[model samples]
Target chain A: MIQLIAYLIIIVLTIIFLIKMIPRKLKKSPPYTCGEPMKFEKPETVFYRTLSNILGLKKLQKLSTGNLNDYLLMIFICFMLLLIVLVMV
Target chain B: MLAPYAVPLLICTAFALPVFKNEKLIKAIAILAIFLSLSFVLSSSIEVFNSGTKVFAVSGFKAPFGIVMVLDKFSSTVASLILFLSLMIAAFSSKLVKERVKEFYTLLLLGIVGSLGIVITGDIFNMFVFTEIMNIATYALIGFTAKKEGLEASFKYLIIGSVSAVLMLLAISLLYSHVGTLNMADIISRIDTNDIYLKTIFIMLILSFCVKIAVFPFYVWKPDVISGSLEPVAAFFIGVMTTTTVYVIIRIFYTILGIYYSTWFSIIAIVTMIVGSFLALLQKDIKRILAYGSISQLGYIFLAFSTGLAFQGMYHLVNNAIIEVLLFLSIGTMLMHKKMMEKISMYAFLLGALSLIGIPPLSAFFSKFFIITGLLEKNLFIYAIISGLISIVTLLYYMKIYFMLKQGEKKIYWPIIILIIAVLLLSFVPVWLQIFKGVEVDLLARNEYVSEVLRP
Candidate 1:
């Protein structure tokens, strides 16, 4: 445990020192939209949509649509599943 | 000696808070009430640790007849932890909660009183009552703002929570019919684990608690609930509320039933872990992400318990509660001071996120390490590996929040600072002290608990 703490402190200090030692300069760049205000969707919306699609969670996400009926149905299914498992065991 | 007074003191204070018209006084009285209760809990914990289990039979009525509050090492530790967090949240909310001051403080204290009762009560029926008390207060707190979204979320929670309550009541009734007593110690002596009826009853009870803890399939209400509630209130829900429910599972499975290590239960926990983590990754809202993250952490605790790693589970319970509270309160600070997000808020969130991801020398790291090692020892290599991979997913979601934070101001939030220190100090706990030794032993020693509570 002592060794672990020592290593943690060392790692943190090393990162801080490395960051401080690195030299960098800030440069202003033109807007990527060519001076037009970009019309784009919220990044989180697009990211979540794509990820959900890739993971095939669209059905699961739809089921959890915050509807009262959907919530009750899920509860009912879970209860039945629990009952089945316990009885079998 | 003061163990029995903790819940009633909070209850009386909660009722009395509304009489005072001054909001600052109301907040002060609420904080004072929690502080007094916390002191009582801490003193009782010291006594219990020094001696053994202490049982307080209500109104001088003995066990199997009247409700009793049992203060073993496990209950004392958990109760103290809950009260401490409640005290922190009470202080934090003093600044955040501007409207309905009296109602907010009253409901917060009442909710905390219910959680305290759940942790300390010896009667199964009494646990159910406290669970309702906590849930009702939680529902009110969630809808305290009375905004459309808040009311909608509270209504959904109420619907699902009522279903859980009915299931718990049904289980309690079945158990009473079988064993003829609601006293947990007495039921332990009478219950036949192999009996199918009793098994069904236990399953009902466990399923109800799983919903309360927002395990997968029943976790749909959580994100909305967290997103809708006031941030400090959300912190209280994620930190104290779910931890207390997990404690109920521990007390029931380990002590009342004396049945440990269920493969089906472990499978449920694993599924909850995987599903919650993945769903968290796909969330856009910070509160929703933390809600799902909390669900995944609950899965870790359940899995630890099902695998017979009671100590590891309890340790992780404490660590997870602290980390969640830290993160939520920091986010609350950021939301409050949006124009200038404090540097302290950023550091607090980052530290909490790192700790949640099980970074080295953090408290959660040790708990996860012990749990994975225990799983490996049980030849559950797949479970161990999945648990490890879930940590990476945890990192991803937390980083999503990290990048969203805009830090500028040098102002400090004392609560977040205190919590950050608490998280750092927690990592030093196991090595520097043996606080959990008695709790770990007491959890597995079902016969000892029974004999203590049933002693004339």
Candidate 2:
């Protein structure tokens, strides 16, 4: 039972991360599309809002002065952290 | 008899290649060398199957102490396939490569030599050395086009490949420290594999190979590498390189480690299949889709292994390699003949993709059917269902290719037609019908493998 729960947790986390990694084109109502109205009113698409918040997708876009290398560095750090967690856990 | 000559001849020819500067002469030499190598591999494979496993010890030393080459069913089958694919690629390359023909052929042959060495070597360290040789040759080959994307892809591949290699080296060093032997059979006999330390090494080694095979999460480097390299080079890497790498994985897990844990392989296989297929659905470029498609196909092969149907895995491995070569070669020809994939190439691509998507009455369908059956036999219903559903994703992506191709002009290529016929013939052949049952029994008897490798 414990093992099953652990597996379920892993699966949920994986899905979340996969959603985060998906390119903006694949995402529905990406942050830029959720603009003016979202600032004052709650978005009708709860899923998009949650994803945006969890992934910090909007913040990254808003702060987008970074180059390709910086993005690559970010990805590398995330990958290393994931690997470490996988191995140690 | 011919099996022993394959590696030496390839290596010698690779070195001899630099002496010639004329492009035609270089291409001819490369083709000749690969043809001879293929002939040797085929002849030796026949001998191996008929008379049982053949062992070739190097420098007058016996097994467990010196390097020995083993020619068994698995190694011979994979080696023959590699050599045949290399031969085709060599012959077809002349039409594609314009400059540095000598370097290209040399690296290509060196890659062949290294892959063959990995297959046949009994010593684990030699396997690592050969892997590095194969990797170096591949890195150079990927950079051969020297476009911006090609160089960047090659550099990225180099970094990822180096990390994998280091992990493998660390695993080897750990095993050596524990068991005090480099010979696979000797180490298998001496080491206590169940120890946590050994298990750690095993995971490390498996992760290293996972990187090579482009399993999920580690597969990020593959699309760029495939897209940046020449079409035929991409085909060879997808088909032959992965075949050899999976062969080593089997060798290590089943033969050397002597441990079976289907759960881990199954989980990873499932993830790889889903992620690969899903991502493939989003790709627009034909080659990138196929590259991602190869990842999904590998997931099937690994899934078979995870179910403990190694014979099925081997069967699917060969089937997938054939499909990959056919697809990539057709794509290459089409690219070379025109800017867009025309009618004939589209037909060729459709045929390959159909086979890949598990259309009935094709070799790929048989392999996949066998794999699913293996999953069912093992009572892995979830995996069986997952595989069944993944085929839909596979079909969708392939249909995307088909619809895209529908827009292109029609023209026929005879070579592709010949490959189409071969694919059909293989689909209908019952050559494996009688043997696979026996193989299923034999693989479960793991002692058979250990005894065969260890017999003094």
Candidate 3:
């Protein structure tokens, strides 16, 4: 049981550290080649404005990215292995 | 009675390390911990030499019902090697480890604990767990130096290591569904009862080992890690840890799975031998050169294990451990360019490389002689010829490194003088005595290892 506690603590701390270490991702700048705007911007200005209005960073994040609760489960597995060994003890 | 002391003492010492503020005190404790561990391993080896196998159940529970530690000729011998190198590394790296001293020693001891657990435990699941513990410590240790390449190598190692862990776990899960027993001996004794599952398990287990050892195509990550790391711990980690995995493969497959299943395992052995040697020849950097050399060396070890020459394989194991560690310690020092340390590591490499390539009379020569002779006795004349050819090729690489070192720009650190002379003495004395005294190590025919382990 104590071993399980220890393993859990280690997992929690490692996850916290790893997250802090991962560099923040930034959006890509429009291509600098040729003076033409990406995807005919003048022709699609209205559509772009509509899309921008509906699909901001928060909306894009909601659509394109999601959390998996990986940290919680990682801790759970570590605790489980620790529990198994402790029980064997 | 001494079984628990190995793990618990290390644990106690590591846990208590934080309370001690003085670096000198921690170094003393680290050295003390490994020395005491070495003493126990040595004593256990003596006991096993006297008897046959030492089997003890944990907490007084019997085998199959509770966890068991088997101190056979095999495990005891490996343990002794582990302690021998580890004690030396602990003593040598003591004053040198500057980063996170407490954590460093703690992880090192923990890594040894995991290795010991992996060797001693009869449970396969426990082996997986111990391997993970070991991987974590080693991965962290690789990054401990805080160098850019060190971090990169550690990350690469982490991903690959994690995959191996998963593969092993999956293999274990599949194995348990059929065998329903985790005790290695129990599994071994009952293995012949199934046919289809037997082969499947062999493939799984072999993949696990090949992945772990990084043999042939699998051996790429090691060079980057070994060559890049500033920590001497990487030297022992490569030297002893990889050796343990190969030994474990032999013990698990041939000893546990029985010879009927293992007879055909030599193909990969031969392939690893050829490929490892081929890559070993093409390296320019000092460490990478030795890295491939270790791979090729693993080839001979695989040959012995596959041929069922357990004792011979083990003799090779010890020889490989000794020669490589000696060479690396010196070479690692040379890489540091501490004046005489430069000449010393290369000179040690020259003599050690001869031993490694199996020239007459050196320790490794005897090991290769046994394997090749064991091969001829098995009537695998082709393998004997191939092994001989590879040894010649390996010798060329050794000579290449020799010439390079002999020709390199002058560096004058002389602590390496003592080390060089030591390697010279070690290389010359034993072989010279054996030749003059006509001391004979009777060459075992094929299947020599099988009979030795089964003998009494």
Each prediction's DockQ against the real complex: 0.41, 0.04, 0.01
When 2 and 3 are scored with DockQ, the better candidate is 2
Higher-DockQ candidate among 1 and 2?
1
- Once fitted onto the true fold, the runs of candidate 1 whose alpha carbons sit more than 4 angstroms away are A1-53, B1-19, B429-433
Model 2 DockQ (Cα-based): 0.04
* Of 1 and 2, the candidate ranking higher by TM-score: 1
Per-model TM-score on C-alpha atoms:
0.90, 0.82, 0.73
- Model 2 misplaced regions, further than 4 Å: A1-89, B1-19, B406-418, B435-446
Docking class of 3: incorrect
Q: Write the per-residue lDDT of candidate 2 for residues B1-456, one digit (tens) a residue.
A: 434346445544655644676789878877778777778878877886777677777886887777888777778888888887777777767878889887788889888888988988888899999999999999989888999878877887787788789878988998788778898777777778657777677667777788777786667668778888888789889878999999888878777776455676778788888877866766668788888899988999888887687877877888888778888887786667665666666677778889888899888889889889878887889999999998988997787666545335565555466667767866863786544544444445456655666677
Query: Across residues B208-298, which tens digit of lDDT does each residue of candidate 1 receive?
Result: 9888878876788788889988889899999999989999988888998886798888988998998888888777788888998998998
Off by over 4 Å in 3: A1-89, B1-17, B260-264, B338-346, B404-456
- What DockQ does candidate 3 have relative to the true complex? 0.01
Interface RMSDs of all predictions? 2.1, 7.8, 19.0
Q: Candidate 1: what's its TM-score on chain B?
A: 0.96
Deviation of model 2 at B247, angstroms = 0.7
Best-to-worst lDDT order: 1, 2, 3
